[model samples]
Target: MVMSANERLFYHVLIRILFVAVIAGSLISLLAEQFWVAELFTHFRLYYLLLQALLVLIFLHTGRHTLMALTILFAMPNAWVAGPYLIPVYGGQRATAKAATSIDIVALNVNYRNDGFARVAGYLRERDPDIIVIAEYTPAWRDELEFLRKSHPYQFGEVRPDPWGLAVFSRLPFMESELIDLADTDTVHARFVFAAGMMSLEVFAVHLLPPKSAVWARNRNLQLENLVDQLGASTHQRIVIGDLNLTPFSPYFSRFIERTGLQDARRVDGFHVTWPVSVFPVWIPIDHALADPEVNITSVHAGPDVGSDHFPLEIRVSKGVNKQPGQVRAVFE
Candidate 1:
């Protein structure tokens, strides 16, 4: 079917508007550190590039070579920024001592108000991860989790009515457990002296206030900075996972990595969005997992949805060597 003159004009106008908006957003978000609204736009760098690529294809099909050229030029900046998070990590030689182990860690945000305990619980049993971290834990959920005691016998956390409540259930025994108060958020911290053949491993579960306004944005930044300070003084082989409420595109996230020397576990093949679960196409990865540079994050992925607005995250770690190859491995296991 052929479009009338007005119909063709309308389609052209709509595409032009979308292209302009995408270009503007890509540039304005660079100042996200100075303003909260800018920070909100910063999280969508990957999405922006995706939209730009689609726009470029449309331009080429419509024989608009100039628009196609400009679109590619603007998309380069976003690609440069979001490139690291989307690509796979460098596959380097890994230590293969006899004590090496592969451990699966899971993180889930069981929305406190969600009445889908059975769904989330069932998902856990199906995955059977060695360690689990939960956000928005509650007294009611605590009782409900009793069924998991047989598999994940060790438990420690703060159960509350608020969304900030956090919990950790593990098959491995905890050497030490504590609750840290950072920027009005109670962060759940857990330690495993010798998990499998790996030596000490410490995990910190953090949830920051959504940065919808200036005050909330500042608080989130403060929480991250304080957490970094604490991490600097903590033991090695550290892992931090939770609903960070900020994406990797944010300057603050870059600072967190720079200051603490932690690597994002999102070194995957493509975008792995984990929030705003819905029928809409808009989605982002606000929930994240980070680890020390030395730890090998074999894979990080989204788990089955558990009746929440966020999908659970499963991270698999491969420590230096085979689990039972060395005498040290046998002694620890």
Candidate 2:
């Protein structure tokens, strides 16, 4: 079939505009480190890729090979950013030592306004991860999670009314715990230490402030930088997990991972978008777990949407922690 001259012109114009938009959007992501607005643009890497892909197909259909080639060329960077997360490691090699133990951790936002206590509680009972870290924790959530006390005997955390509140319940025993509050940044985060044989392991859990404005963005970046020091002396194998409110595409995120040397869970798990599920066609991964180079991300599973705008993340981390041989710990209600 042959297109009319008018139709050809219209398609060409539309494709050109989209190609330009994609290029601008991609460039803005590069300035994420310097500008908060540019940082926001970094979150939707997949969206940019999709838009460029659509343009490429349209240009090809219209027989505009030059524009298609240019679109494809620009789309490569976006593809590189989103590709690793799209394809997860199905079954990576693991440590075969007899003492190696892997534990499943459930990280949930548990929105403050949501009153679906039973729904969230039921999912916790069903999934039954060895460790459950609750963000956006409230006073009301305290009683609701009591049932878990039996299985996860060693519990630690703070109950607050704000979104930054957090709590952790774990079946494994904790050797130490800290509520890190940086004086300058006014950011509070939870850190728990556990023993795995002679090796000490640290789990840093947090729900950083969302970059809603310039002030919040400034604090968020400060909090991210401060966390490196707040995490302290690197004497333990670290596992940093929770709702960072910043996506992997952001330059700050890349720098944090580089400076901290923690591996992102997404590299092991497929592209898991956990936020803004309430909205259609607009979602990016803000929740994440980054572990030390020696630690292993066995698997990660998405929990059912139990009333929070963000879904839950069930992650299995192994090869660093230790467990007794067939000796089970007692449960207390």
Candidate 3:
């Protein structure tokens, strides 16, 4: 059916308005990365890129010069930001030779309210990871996880009822372990020495506050900065794993990577959405496994949802020849 002149004009104007809005919105979102207040938008960079791509397709049919310009404007920033993650050329590298000294770590944020204790315990038993890091680990959750004591005899962190409760259980013996307080959260820092005693790996189980408000976001940034400082001073093969509560696309996450010199395990393995498992589109990779340059990530993948808002992340890393003997000191006050 052919449209009347009035109807055609109405659609034309509507398309123009949307086109301009898309361009403006995309630009604002891209620029918002520089500021802490706009962190909520930065968390969904992948969603923004996908939305812009959809808008481009819709604008292509309009054939208006202004719409074309807007489409280009919208596409450029999204592509530039999302290109590295989407393209295979920027993928992470695997360790050339498999070293005898390697560790398998599993990080998960089991929602404090979710009572999937049996499911979580079963998954842990099946995976049998060398190290297990849990966030939102309440006192009850600790009781449920006690069954793991036989395998993971070495445990660290507190078993509080708060959402920030953190814990780490390892089969490997700990050379040194300490619980350090960040601004409003606690982080577990431990060094595990292999049985052979020739090499060691420093493990940090971190759980930063969720950026729900401006104050929280700023505090989370501070925690990240402090963590980076601590990791930077370390002289050992390091693995920072847990519910960081910030996606890799966020400005704070980028800053953390830059300051700590840690490589994201997802870089080599591919994106594995870990949060809000109940929701598909809004899911993001808040749980992560970051390793120092000397540690090579052999494999990284998200585990099956065991009744938690966040899925578990399992990462395997090979220790490099370069080993530093000193432990990382906590800088948090």
Candidate 4:
């Protein structure tokens, strides 16, 4: 039986829409390396699911070949709705400042492609964060960061002679600094000390490798799990910050939170976007700051873009009295 022209055209358009949506959603996941599509579709997951359901009509009329293709296409977006959708909604909570004694820290991944080092440097200097973690650093960035020595006199992490570099700077002194290589080609990890009275808080700055493949994704989660376990065992109050390359929506991210007992600063209120700064006003929070329970997070904010693919993340956190030296207990129970 030959189909009518109007019906054929309708099915064609429907298939095209489904195909485009799937690609767009997958691209968002790939480029952002975070659960970006989930956040983007948070408010519309149900609507999208319904739309996909309606696509069945187009599928049934178009024949089995088109039906299978449309089915696969629609499944991509809905796949994100699985475990990830639960996270940005329930995992990453934005914390509010409650009292005085809280310290502040900021984590940002100033996209390596950016050349506005001075602007990024200036922004940090103005914010005057107690601690700052930067990923995707380059040797060229070193000169621009010299100004930071004035305030955050203490710093660590080498200038990656290569393209992908990671570093940390802080007003607080350090007990030790080491690079953590998770079999990745980049040197993107750093650890340092944040001292106050009888206690010293250890911080690890990590930028996981881009999770483009299933193996890489699993390894990224494993590396993070190892890092979390190490920190959780330590007696000092700890904080993990940087571009984890995974979002709350990912199973790895949830495992890290559950394993490390850390809290996402944005989970309480709403998600923040940090990539493709040029697309201003329409951003999703890819950068993050996760802290152990001992660290009292005051507030977290998205700062202005500095000619980078990612926007800076600003946060204020304080040390709780329970974080004292004698109060050495397992960080995550």
Q: Would you estimate the TM-scores of all the predictions?
A: 0.87, 0.86, 0.82, 0.68
Tell how far residue 32 is off in model 1, in angstroms.
0.4
lDDT per prediction? 0.78, 0.78, 0.73, 0.64
lDDT tens digits by residue: candidate 2, 81-123: 8756666644443323222366778999999877899989989
**Model number with the top TM-score:** 1
Candidate 4 regions off by >4 Å? Answer: 1-100, 183-186, 196-199, 280-283, 321-333
TM-score of candidate 3 to 2 decimals? 0.82
TM-score ranking from best candidate downward = 1, 2, 3, 4
The lowest-lDDT stretch of 10 consecutive residues in candidate 3 is 324-333
Winner on lDDT between 1 and 3 is 1
Of 3 and 4, the candidate ahead on TM-score is 3
lDDT of 3 by residue, 165-259 (tens): 77888888887788877654454333333432354677777788887877777778888877776776666667788888888877678878766
Candidate 4 lDDT tens digits, 1-333: 898999989977877787567545544543333553343433233344445555655556657566657565755655564434345555455556434466667777776667887788778877777777777777777777777778887787766755458878777777766777754544568877667555677777877765666666657666776686678666676777777776565545656676666767554334566665774454445577776655655566677876677778777665554343222234356
Better by lDDT, candidate 2 or 1:
2
Query: Distance from true position, residue 36, model 3, in Å?
Result: 4.2
- Candidate 1 lDDT, 205-267, residue by residue in tens: 877778888988888888988888778777656778889998888889888877777777676
Please say which candidate is ahead in TM-score: 1 or 4. Answer: 1
Query: Could you tell me which 10 consecutive residues in candidate 4 have the lowest summed lDDT?
Result: 322-331
